[model samples]
Target: MIEVNFDGIVGPTHNYAGLSIGNRASFANAGAVSSPRLAALQGVGKMRRMLAMGLGQGVFLPHVRPNTDWLRTLGFNGSDTETLASAWMSDRALVANAMSASAMWTANAATVSPAPDTRDGLCHLSVANLSTMPHRASEAGQTERQLRLAFPDPRFFRIHAPLPAAFGDEGAANFMRIAPRSGGPAVEMFVYGEGQSGGFPSRQHRTASEAVARRHGLSPARSLVVRQSDAAIAAGAFHNDVVAVANGHVLFAHEAAFADPAALYAALAALVPDVVTIEVPADRVSLDTAIRTYLFNSQLVTMPDGGMTLVLPGEAQENAAVWAWLNELIAQGGPIDRLEVVDVRESMRNGGGPACLRLRVQVDADALAAIDPRFLLNETVCARLEQVITQEWPESIAPEELGDPRLWDRCARARSALTEALGFGTDEL
Candidate 1:
């Protein structure tokens, strides 16, 4: 096997994604490729954005508690999402639930899936967890900028018109959005569409998922429901850009979409101009987590002194030591602004992570320009989303708030404000 020394340029940089993608390879334009699913690739362009990792397979014993020793190898968990403490460990795995204890949380959480729209941090969807959007509040340049988010009441439960069911769950927005820290506009996301199988939650899990969506003022259709397939199993989908630093050729794959692997692989080849497959052996359990997973990880934004921190990848993989490798690189003067690690013990106790809990935005140069960074600060952004109509969004809110519109504004304003202030960057007074 030929080794691509990522330690050179790419190595000295920080990669929150545990992507141990080969560095010696080259890249192909994602546009040149073709896929039956994408009539036109909305996310991709000539210059693409960077993605976290390729396909992932969480290997663990059946009926295993998410984070525990004796699992062997580079320690991983049944669930990808884990607490910050566990995530930053040289070898640790925590359950996503551990990090999600708020009134508005779900069990299906996977990865936070960072995006540039999020201004450069984790894109999450926990209606129960969101309190205040991170902001400087003091002065403009006095504190610099990332995102200007004005959170709305989660109990508001405002509904968007032209319901998802009325149409085919067309314009569904998921919990994904841009990081306000990066100072970008918030982007609507839909992890799954309403009409799809996982579209509208049915059983308890489904209902719970919907409730959280409604609580956070997200569109059900925003989620990517794995359309029925002969492949035996299905899950959600993630759209992201995969840049093969080793190959120079940028391969774009929708990392979020855990639908039909083969079909997705084909679609990726189509949407991406150049395609080099990055595969991890498929295990039924891992596949299940992949489809119905929600895990999130983040790093602290660099301070004025040029220091920033990010939540690290807890467990280690054959080549996926997101924490160990990056930490060492930073210590070696990797040119990183700064890095911060969180325990997310609270989130893990509830079952979630920095990654699985949030959302992201489009990083494409052209698409990014059209967006107004100020939208992140709109006090009514969340409420507005509740009322806006989009072919891609869903017609129904989450079950609890499904038909009702009050749930959107129910979150305690004072409590939320305090939590968000601390969550983003505000220090104790």
Candidate 2:
């Protein structure tokens, strides 16, 4: 099976509103001016890098921002412009939530079980309710719509609606799959947190993880539900991906990532005996340094030549501690043989890294072909996307400009132009 990395196109409304509660970078960069055009271009550059590496690459379009429809449900009624203005006057925070571009972090879009691992032999995806944050709760419906359009063939895909909001599912960011290789039966690990930690709420509930597992028909023996370390969460590791990431037979994580690392490692070893774990000790890179630099958030992808590469954000390269440890790991000839750093400063400022920006899906040849062609990326597609972004996306957006009707109109038109450029209809996206 070919593993495809479907990245969410950075939206025109991309801003530093600091909507996420536990994400330190988001809070630190809140209210700062953002470069929407640069953000989108950077995301496209990442996709292009993946393509150049001979990996399957796809795109998930941005959602309609300044969600005036959601405001109507909240008792604001009028034309879109009028509603937005009134909502802005009544509650600036509400308007900010409505205009959030957090959906570009596609890792939180859904939890997917590939065709090889499900009982029905079809890929199963459950849209995350994201109930933990008010700004993110409204994404489920639109996310489900996009997933359905991308994987329409019932024979190869089953898209489930978001679980009830009470469960508070946050999707693939808190989940990991370990197999001998891609496209094979593997052990699925669900990392959940309990109670509040370090003044931040633990987003993924254990019950929610169980619900997704059952919905996907995963057997108990192959599924392990574990707890995320309170220390890590308190350190601002809002999602498990921030502290750990698994690809193929390797699990690269910070030492403080899980509550009981020994047991989790033992369980994984039992399931996949040859599992290669590269755990970075706190002495080398403290939890604070790891979270601050997003050292563990790198994309640990298997290259076409059977070697693994860590696609890290530029932040990791800037920090002396993080960079030294990575260099040492490479010098020692660890599972991660090479490092490739890409600049996603706009996203990094908003608390998302390379891994958070994309959703990984493993699909066989037939299932791969079943996906919508427009969502797939190539050199031509990337060039067209770059052109559209340059021409249409806003150059910069300050916090005060979020409520501007003119900005809203530009954002809408940018999405429209993107849709047309991709040969999608107005209603299709």
Candidate 3:
């Protein structure tokens, strides 16, 4: 019963490339961060970053991470990052079965958080036991239902065995108790929470979220919570939700990883909606690792033709005030058609863009119904990697082209604050 929906997105390939180690690892070249059309869009966002490691971050293998000059200076091209990187690598699933990846998490105890379920294609969410992974308990040999699905699946409802400590969650596997509420099923959805394995001060994540709300019978104190806590948020950051959306309406970002940004914005305004929050103050030079990365590096998507596409972080105005208030709420009606960000911070900074790194998975409404907006409006991989960097440095022998033209006009106003935060229309990118 893992149908699934939450606006899934996953990657920031931005015209990716493969082979690297330049500047003289023996001059293998390539490296300015790969091109030839961002290595065909990093072979398709490396397949939704390997399905966003099953909605968490247990990424068993995933490798490759070049950056593609952050999608060739923002405007994508090379065919809209190769049509969303070759449809996320023709729907991946084989890097030796994504390195035998594992996932699971369950804990509703009414509404402490973490639900989204799935099975074979991996996404269970919380079950319990501990020792994580198929219940890899202590490992030496491994069993307990495979170490309780091996990590992740935190808990669902009525679990025990020393598991909860306010979800300080030691290696979860799967668990959930939600489903009932008078006719049991749809809780209208909306929980946000993000600190302390969350489920809260744990009673085994509230007795496995009240035994998955009494095995789908429902009613756990009405439901609906919106936290952002952060006792350091680990168990792989409480098994990330990849921008959740099972009709829950989400948009969470609580930066204190360094500690106290107004107590992580009052624990994310007590849990979501001020328009799904996106304050981003990271003390000053902002971007809190792109808010712990909005699902494997970037997204807003919904194209095919109707509209809405922000992808994010490749400076067209530095999140242009969050894509110009989401392009004026998509010009009042809010049906966004295109935005796409992706930045490598001018080629490597302590962070990348859109959201530091990448992760997320699941997407197939017939390949997002075939997105477009003329595919990030294209100009051909930024006019072909600016004609291969002024033809391998020859504007008469580069040296930053002999220096200032106002340092290329302050690097074009710090790249126009990330291309005016991506509202587009600088004559259509």
Per-model TM values vs. the true structure:
0.30, 0.99, 0.22
Error of 1 at 237 (Å): 10
Clashing pairs in 2: none
Displacement of residue 378 (Cα, Å) in model 3 is 12
Q: TM-score winner between 2 and 3, please give it.
A: 2
**Candidate achieving the largest lDDT:** 2
List RMSD in Å for every model shown: 20.8, 1.0, 22.8
Candidate 1: tens digits of C-alpha lDDT, residues 1-429: 011000000000011111111110101111121211111011110001111111111100001112123222235444332322334353221212121112111111121222322322323323111111011001111101112132122221121222122112211112222223223233233333222243322111223334444444443433322332212111322211110000112111223333355774464344333544433233322423322222122321223343433333232111233334444646865334344433333222222233322222222333233333322222233222222212112222221221122321221222234234323334311
Relative to the unseen true structure, what is the C-alpha lDDT of residue 394 in candidate 1, on a scale of 0 to 100?
Answer: 23
Task: Rank by lDDT, highest first.
Answer: 2, 3, 1
Instruction: Count the clashes in each prediction.
Output: 139, 0, 94
lDDT string, candidate 2, 292-314, tens digits: 88888888898999899999999
Error of 2 at 347 (Å): 0.3
List the candidates ranked by TM-score, beginning with the highest: 2, 1, 3
Give the poorly placed runs of model 3, Cα more than 4 Å off: 1-226, 233-348, 352-370, 373-383, 386-405, 408-410, 413-426
